[model samples]
Target: MAMLNPMPYEFLGVRHKPNLNNFFGFIYAKVTVPSSVKVPVLPWKDPETEDTIYPRGFFTGHYFSEELKAVEKLGYKVECYIGYEFSQQSLFNEYVNHFYEAKSKAKERWNFEFLTKEEAANKMFYTYAHEVVELNENHLILVSDTTPSRELLEAQDTDSVFVQNPLPQDIVGSGLGQFKDELK
Candidate 1:
């Protein structure tokens, strides 16, 4: 949940600062600002002529979606600001607190019921995630000695590996993608 927070501009598609070169984040919108209208000096405004340069191009790094909505009401075509809205601080804080409480109180371990050896092997082969358990940033415990190998699949189709948490019980979570220990 912390990683999914939009603070990391590149990862969550929400840039903290304005960027005009590329629409890497969801902050920028492609609009057509008219020359007839009187507006403030924006980033895309022409320095000498004081006119809108990119009439039908992206203008980025300045205004929020609410301000852009006002522009849309002025007969301008604005795209990519409808569904996205910046979350209120209190709402975001409540969401974070809920997840924190859930994680802190969770006492169950990850149950790999109905997981086949082949599926486990494939996940390991692609993501290098051992038994789908992320231990820490730099260290992860490999669940099986012979997983991701053809020998495990050929042995039994129903066969699967079990993961035992070697770390302290206080460091475990009951949900998927939760930390197995201190996230450092």
Candidate 2:
């Protein structure tokens, strides 16, 4: 799917907020695993109850503060990156597949050196999913494979890209976010 480049005029016409209960786009941090520790765990604090729990990996950056503190307390390393998450399994899979195809097509069609910087970045976006990791039992985490895999419990970022306007009638149901996939 071609990327949407909504201009300033488009933003002026938008009336409703996009529902982001299902998508996540944010700055993500993951605790880096050191060779000394065979298994690394994330110390997460529940804000509502103020209880701390350790999870294998987190799905989003909502716990940025807690995570930073936990890593500092443990004397461990943490790596941050731009990440995207999808709660719905099918949507997540679709996103991964879409980017993978775009990356492949770009490699086949153009030499990276010839593309402008922005064009290179757009292509890089396609390559980011090669490191996607399904965490927290049901959610998926997307990153670049060149980086280490995430190993923390689970969390989700509330911020996301939402369609500010309605899709055409013919494409309403077929539009992005229209296809709902329940967690299994």
Candidate 3:
């Protein structure tokens, strides 16, 4: 129930770009600037143009999404910002608070229903993740208070490429890429 809060899953499909979708009706009401989160910037400027290549802002006037700023082998340089508008604050606060609440509740569920985090983690690494994992900077979305976040992507010794996350990586789906063979 809480996972589907703010907006329903199907409803979120509006902004999915036909590949990935999300409910975008929760548009930010205020137009003020955002400044809570800090994003990393490039250390050097464009040699030929004599200008910075990236602007390093997160408020794209749409929903929650980030452009991969840079990659350091296994980690990503990501951008994060908090807007000041009433609508902006409302949405941001809701997302954060709701997520925290969900995590707490889910952890309780895990201990009550299944096993402890240590047991699950140490006992063959059996997946006890309640739902789709959303690795935050230091916590798993609705998993545990002490569940640590990864600092870099651990590629599975294969050539498959995937986006980086400050938290951890949990890709949703691929559209055309999923059906590339069928397209061919």
The top-ranked prediction according to lDDT is 1
Instruction: Give candidate 1's root-mean-square deviation (CA, Å).
Output: 18.8
Write one digit per residue (lDDT tens) for candidate 3, span 1-184. Answer: 2232333223322221221112223222112222432334323354679765433433223223211212222143222232111111233445656655665677578753343565445344324433566577654444444322223333322223222433222323222112111111
Clashing pairs in 3: 12-22, 12-23, 16-20, 16-21, 34-83, 103-142
Model 1 Cα lDDT, one tens digit per residue, 83-121: 322332333556666765565455234332333477567
Q: Best candidate per TM-score, number? A: 1
Tell me the spans in candidate 2 whose CA falls farther than 4 Å from its real position.
1-39, 46-88, 113-184
lDDT by residue for model 2 over 1-184, one digit each (tens)? 2223211121122112222222233225555545555345665667779777654434324433333545646656555443333222233555656765675577668833345576566558647745765466323333433224333312222322224343355643423434312121
Q: What TM-score against the true fold does each predicted structure earn?
A: 0.24, 0.21, 0.19
lDDT of each: 0.45, 0.42, 0.32
